[model samples]
Target chain A: MRIKAIQWALSAAVLAMSASAFSAPPTPAMLSNACAGCHGTHGESAGPSMPALAGQSKISIVESMKGFKSGERPSTVMGRLSKGYSDAEFEAMGEFFSRQKPFTTSQTLDRAKVAKGAELHEKNCARCHVENGKEIKDNSPVMAGQWVKYLEIQMADYHSGKRKMFDRKAERMKPLSQSDLDAIAHFYASVK
Target chain B: MTIDRRSFLKMTAGAGAAGVLYGCASTGPSGSTADVMPKTGRRVVVVGGGYGGTIAAKYIRMMDKNIEVVLVERNDHFVSCPFSNLYIGGLMKDLSPLTIRYDKLAANHGIKLLQAEVTGVDAASRTVVTSKGTLKYDHLVLSPGIDFRTEEVKGYDIATTPEVIPHAWKAGPQTVLLRKQLEAMPDGGNVVLSIPLAPFRCPPGPYERTSMIAMFLKQHKPKSKIIVLDANPDIVSKKGLFLKGWKKHYEGIVDYRPAKKVTEVDARSKTVLVEGLEDVRGAVVNLIPPQRAGQIAVAAGLVGADKNWCPVNPTTFESTIHKGIHVIGDACVAGAMPKSGYSANSEAKACATNIVNMMNGREIVDFSGINTCYSFLSAKEAVEVTGVYKVDKEKNTIIAVPGTVGVSPDLSELEAIYAESWLKNILIEMST
Candidate 1:
């Protein structure tokens, strides 16, 4: 009877493991579906102010989410939303967004501002952003083809100390005026 | 009682003839017959094509293409209430932007669109009787939205006198009517807007409506005033921001009176009677009556002890009363979740996930959702209230996570821009 009891326990343990194995872990697509409501489908936003998340590097997305969750980043809504997810979920979402096609803005840009912003980008941002902010190397998110208005808001946040910026980028941005930032936004948006 | 082959054959023939005759007789004037829908291997029948129902249908198909999803809605097109106030405020020139056709849901997502009213649900048989025909389902999702409790207010019948005192709550023809009344009123005319009690659909909707009407009056008729009779003790949502906006933009134009319950309405005289205060007259009366779960839910006996809203398992949104039936949107009693379009959309996604899991014989996971409701203070500025929620399995209820429930720091044009984006994105998510 003792042997039978032990055998029964062993089978129950095996059954539990098998049951868990049959239930697959949630995929990145599943984890990121909730973000589509405001961020647009596949992380491509339709509005100018809401930033598109498509094709952003995994590290950039994770870092931004961590900042939002920790209150290190000031946001209108993301600060509250970020608290709902875990680091693991954020990683999954980052990986999902990284695999999507990059966003291309349909908004019209000021031609003169774009030209001026190109000079500003080459002077300050191109070192890190690379390829006129089109390259996603060095863990930087793709700035080219991003929404112009959203880029302007981020610059404003950094200027106001509402958002923390890395020391090097902050130093580079400190000398630029608001119009220069606007020009930079136009320059990035003008990219295909 | 055993039957031989010859006797069984006779019985089968007789039954087949009767079945054919019955099928012929049951065909109605609408060219609908009983049990006309062809059965797929696994089918989910979603009634009502509002925010919740459409999302549920589309996501279910997106999650599992093999599972057939049929979306039944009375209206051929969807008119979003989220931005209807803008249409009424004249920020939008027409209702075209607010309206969405169900064609994409059918063509893009492979959802079978049925434009029919659901008359009854036979839970025991797992069949839904609609105006068109009876549809069988492996699972059912009901998101009929809200129906007014018109009986709560004396001398108010929405059916008979919708134009006289337009509630405009449901947004469509009523929205146009309210806009027209505002346009026709004299420059200095007083517009009376009544608010219903709590647990109503869109807690901040009336306040936003008040703001929009105030905007219209302020621009078109400077002397015009809006008398807001709120049934609640105070503003139920984004209280400080709404108050600040009213004070800053519409100091004298918006006369907000809280704790004043609307008891009756004299539609002919265009007067509203308060429980304790004197009767108030208006050039245009926007009386928003109390609401409950939509008629189909009430008829299906899905409502809980409150006899108002349906109760469901927070994780799956499946009806607590019926085994295979799920209820969502404004019809369900979602803990700590306001009855907003965003909430409904969130609930639908969670519900769709579980329904797909259940069909695949997978374990159902817990529920987590986010709700963000944006209210425009003006054409250019808006405020938002958001909450991140998770289910407490022990309590069998959903609770907002700590530090995740908050309103916007202040109203701004930036949020207004986000608000438009939110609507645009959600519509795309739900429809496409």
Candidate 2:
């Protein structure tokens, strides 16, 4: 998994460089506007189930596209959609989304679950998602202020083996029950 | 001077034959005597305020604020056809949530909203004649959606008696009428829904309507049945999923008879006469008749040999027959792309981008878009079909990429939630 991630990073970097060489490639807005139907204008999703793409880490976005395209990641629709875009388009979209302000859901969160979730995050997820998942890292997604429902769905996918995660992350997730994961999702959602 | 219908048709035909000779200098025909809308710099006048027109107007402004955009719509409010089935099935409470006002679009994007019926388009003159007045444009966009061919279905005149035999295809009042008819139907009554052939708006729509109506019947009128009369040999989209859903939830409630094409309808008796089959009687009859491009598109001579849909250069959505005029949404012949609101929204964005590029002398990029359509089998469970499309330069039309189109393996509640979210986000994108 680590080796594959490294290869994707390398190829994305090469593609990004080649994309800049074009005289006038499509503007990032033009490429990304195609996603506005579900992802919202500028990637700040209006719906709670869909994840907001605005302010996501460039590497994370690029990796997710590669994963979906290669069938290494299972998705309801992204697997098919990701196949349509080129690696260069993915790089452009990554840059485009990373520049926008992060979207914070306006949904009401359970206070008790959020309080419990903070503790769970520190114990299980703090190692990789540092700063309560607020600080965006090179390879990590920005979890703070994400939709709780979307987070819950992703966690379920990881548990069901529908989506593959890194070994250490998977190991940490193994012991967490559904309620525990729900609390963790609430905590992440409560960050903003 | 008031001209009769016969003379008007004759005058238009003469003008069409001599359009090239007349050029942009001649103002073809005088419509309303109202003053023409003053043109300011580079302007694009988009006719119709549906998904395609609204998004194109907004995105064009987003891309370049300098270019003036005018959106002309007949109706003041936009009622979506996407979720109207829910309303007809009694799942959705009212149409208020589905109806969107254009005020925000005008205020947020600085678009000029003209509520007027488009009478004609003089392509050579680069002007559109509406009931209110005439409007000149550097570029014109016609996204007028679809118009029904009621003549094909003999003895069924939707224009004259829509309340009696509702198509409810365009939503709004027709949707309300259909729901009312369903509610008034007796417990053991039949509801006959006749679907037109393929290439009609929303391929999976008739099936979804069937499921929704079945859901209503299974709850309120258990003994009631819905007779689905499809012209095609089989279901056009999500065939396996829809069949499975019907078998699982609506067994004995939905009587699906494929290849049963409607030949005529007796409105008074509420009976549908089918080809090669006996007549089917129903308390409520829904006849989705054959359709072509909207009146304005056809008047502009955008439709090609098919005479049903407009052919366009997929990259820019510019009309193949008429330069400087683009057509999008269900009105255009989008190869392999289903006629749905999502497809229209996607095409609108691509069209807007290309228009802005053309105006600024920039290179026009190839067109690429995504379409995701979800159909509810029941109130909670739903199935989806998604596709990613790109323009085939050789064919000059959009085609789905090989590995980028498929339906959901199965229906689920999660997909239903996603479906709602898709609608919400798309509404926000188009309206605000």
Candidate 3:
């Protein structure tokens, strides 16, 4: 009985040591499987309603997910998806998407307004969206060459009752004038 | 900052090893090995591992070596309710530091830590049935924490906890869930947070959480804003401090809408429709709905028909309804004292001391002590209030013993550092 007890204690100690060791983060495949449901395959996102996730900064994506899980950010969709995922999974997902080539922003604008829109876009949006409105692969949205109609609709929907999104980072567009909106749309859509 | 393996072990093992080493080495040879042995070995079962149950279990073993304490908690870890707001802001990362492993209790303090949920408490037979096994106890201390009355809000239930707005009042999966929702949302999305009326656990919790969310939006989602729909007319504790932080740090960053009660939540449409206000289209919604004691309290026929909380004797914390069962934490009608971790910890100490005194053939102390609640405003800054309460003879309520309280000075860089240090030290004391 005494020898058995000593062996059991030794096993417990070994288990504790092993838990501390080999704590390397979860692999990218594990993260891809975890995030593929909501974020879609290759992190492209399935629909317009779900924000596109092809090229988001790894730090921003991890932090945002952490926020939702911890009550810093509150959403049902992200909340449900974030649960059961370890912190290492968050890092892996962020790194995987950050390395992928960014999707080309779709082209949709008239040539007449592109010049005026360029000036406005450079002044207002360049602080967050750098690299010719393409966002350097993974920071903000790829405003360049995105659908003009979608951009116009989203800007107008900010103050209106039809659309309600809550990423506080994007609230700067809330007070944009119609002319300011038109100029930004034309400039971004002209990219690529 | 990359942490090496050696440093990490030192930081993590500092508390647990220090406690046991002190227990055996500090005292004389008589107090060393002799004191380490269990004297009573009497089975004392604790349900929750929050402020009350965790402190009670630790202190009970400290006072008498013989008492065998078995703490059955559902979660594998314990998260501090005090500084949870700081977590909302990007100030503190990795909630693992804020949480403590249960292994420390069993390893250092000789307490049996069971990671299982207790389903029923057989008071008559004196057996607590958990998912694992039947635990027989001589004295039972229940501090299972509060449970939200989800039925009060329309279209909201336990399933909504992870899917829609996560009411992360209870930590773990819910906390992780809320964080993910925040990440997937567009920058200009509408975030709606509802604050229920007074008498809930942690009165200032809702405001602090809202403030942190606002701070996050200001920096990252600059165009996004938060709408606070509060049921109460005025803010509860630390209203001035939280208001100052909001106006100074997050001014023009978010909107503060008060006195709007959330009537129903449409999980399907992702909307929370409040009474006497506009229908809120929230990309992420945090419905901090109504709350009541845990299911065990109601099952044991402890709570009154008033449907508010269970009543207990002010002197002993013994349940008014049940004889053997003792109610502490948020479940009981603890007068005047706010339902906070500090108050619960203080009450647990008093109850444990009294129980021990009775068993050892001594008198129990009836005097009241201090009850302090510290709430973090920003990651660094904290505002705290302490109340020295005494039971009123004629009124039969716990009244604040006049002029026996103190508040921290106004916000400063120094104050923030102090709050951070206090949070770390307190978590260590509570968990280990």
- Tens-place lDDT per residue, model 3, B307-400, is 7688876645667665546678888787877898767776676566544544443343452534556566665666666665555545545566
Task: Score each candidate by Cα lDDT.
Answer: 0.84, 0.85, 0.64
Classified by CAPRI criteria, candidate 1 counts as acceptable
Give each model's clash number.
Answer: 0, 0, 37
- Which residue pairs of candidate 2 clash? none
Interface RMSD of 3: 22.6
In candidate 3, position A57 carries an lDDT of 64
TM-score on alpha carbons, each prediction = 0.89, 0.91, 0.61
lDDT score at residue A108, model 1, on the 0-100 scale: 86
Top lDDT hit: 2
lDDT by residue (tens digit), candidate 1, B1-432:
333334423543464533211122332565453564767467899998888998899889988998999999999988899989998888998888878889977899899988888877767556676777667788999999999998888898777767799999898999999999999999999999999999899999999999999999999988899999999999998999999999989899999999989988889999999983579999989999989999889887899999999998887788878767899999999999999998998889888987887776556656768789999999899999988887775576889988888989987988998898898888876777
Give me the candidate number with maximum DockQ: 1
CA shift of B398, model 3, Å: 2.6
Better of 2 and 3 by DockQ: 2
Per-model B-chain TM-score: 0.93, 0.93, 0.86
Individual DockQ of the candidates?
0.32, 0.27, 0.01
